[model samples]
Target: MRLMLLIRLIFLLLLNGVVLSYAHAASLAYEFSRVSNNSTEDLGRQLSMLVTEQSGGALFTFSNRLGVPSSITDIYFDDASQPLFSSIAYHSDSGAGVSFDSQAAPANLPGGNVIGFLAGFSGDSSAQSVEGGVATKGVMKNGVNSTDEWVSFLGLWANAGSFDGLIKAFADAHFRVGLHVQAIGLAGRSDSYVNQPSPVPLPAAAWLFASALFGFIVIANRRKV
Candidate 1:
């Protein structure tokens, strides 16, 4: 009977460790690069928007200061190198100087709405063409490792011709670009964090708890004998 009780205690302790590990794994955290507002250097050729820490899931604002045509082309979530969503923006021949074709399908986001809006040239006028908009989604949580996540923006300027044209235009002076990004949510983590070499470290408390339980079991078994 004492042996059976010992086995049960060990099982319970192991289960508790697993639960704690899972809680740590799912504790959402995030990090992001500061938006480099470069419009001054490029004479409206560059600009930036921000998704600040205070706004949990609010839409930020963006602008195109360069007299030349420009628009946001893509948005990346979690991984800056890999865009989860994208869009197309261009000046219409006749109507609003700028229009957007958002590829934001909510299915891509884990939760919440993908919100967007237009302003300036896209909203009011196109003469100076000083208009743009921002969009965002999901309740960014706070944590690190599996918990960390973020969003990034990709904008383009004076792009014409085919998609190939845009690539070529990237090399030209008239073609400008900008970026705006922020890490929303909480939990502490470094921006450059990568997976640690595994055999995950066991928390010291787990070891202590297991040792205490084992001692208690030994005492109980002696008493039983």
Candidate 2:
């Protein structure tokens, strides 16, 4: 009887641990989409709606990271306007040099193109620009632009911040911005051209796992007694 109780206890612990780990591994992912020929207001509305739906009616933050001032102000549309709200004062990523050039073809801002920028728009002016087709700015650290040479824009988006601010700015500037969201990360850095996702804790699954584990521990203790 003692041996059976011990085995069950161990099995319960293991199961609890497995469930918790699975919950932790399940990160928050944003459903991203590209917007086309739409005003920044329109984009904001869509994003706000998406956040409400995804976060279950919670007020979430939004931002934008444009490599160029004009990209934030211009490009999203033909009209010049202001954003709904000023960008929040957040630290820019140091380490690598990042920039944006709208005149560059193929990379020129448009309705359907997606781009990624380094986390934290803060950095040196001299670092090599992520523009010109070399995407994926690798782990930005210490004000140096040490991004990998091979990654492309799409790859950068995989780890970029959501450009919620830029989208708002564009709309305020009277330009229509349309974007199709692909995915949202719980945590990540943002820049002028790209919006990285951040890492966040798991949802209700985590709580459920914890409750199960607690119940298991109590039952196991009673059996041992």
lDDT against the true structure, each candidate? 0.29, 0.31
**Residue 21 of model 1: what lDDT?**
61
lDDT tens per residue, model 2, 65-173: 2211111211121212332222212122222233422222223334333332112111122223454466434223212121221111110111222344333333343
Q: How far is candidate 2 from the true structure (C-alpha RMSD, Å)?
A: 14.6
lDDT score for residue 92 of model 2: 29
Which portions of model 2 show Cα errors greater than 4 Å?
Answer: 24-195, 221-225
lDDT of 2: 0.31
Worst 10 residues of 2 by lDDT: 149-158
In model 1, what is the error at residue 178, expressed in angstroms? 15
* Worst lDDT 10-window in candidate 1: 139-148
Name the top TM-score candidate: 2
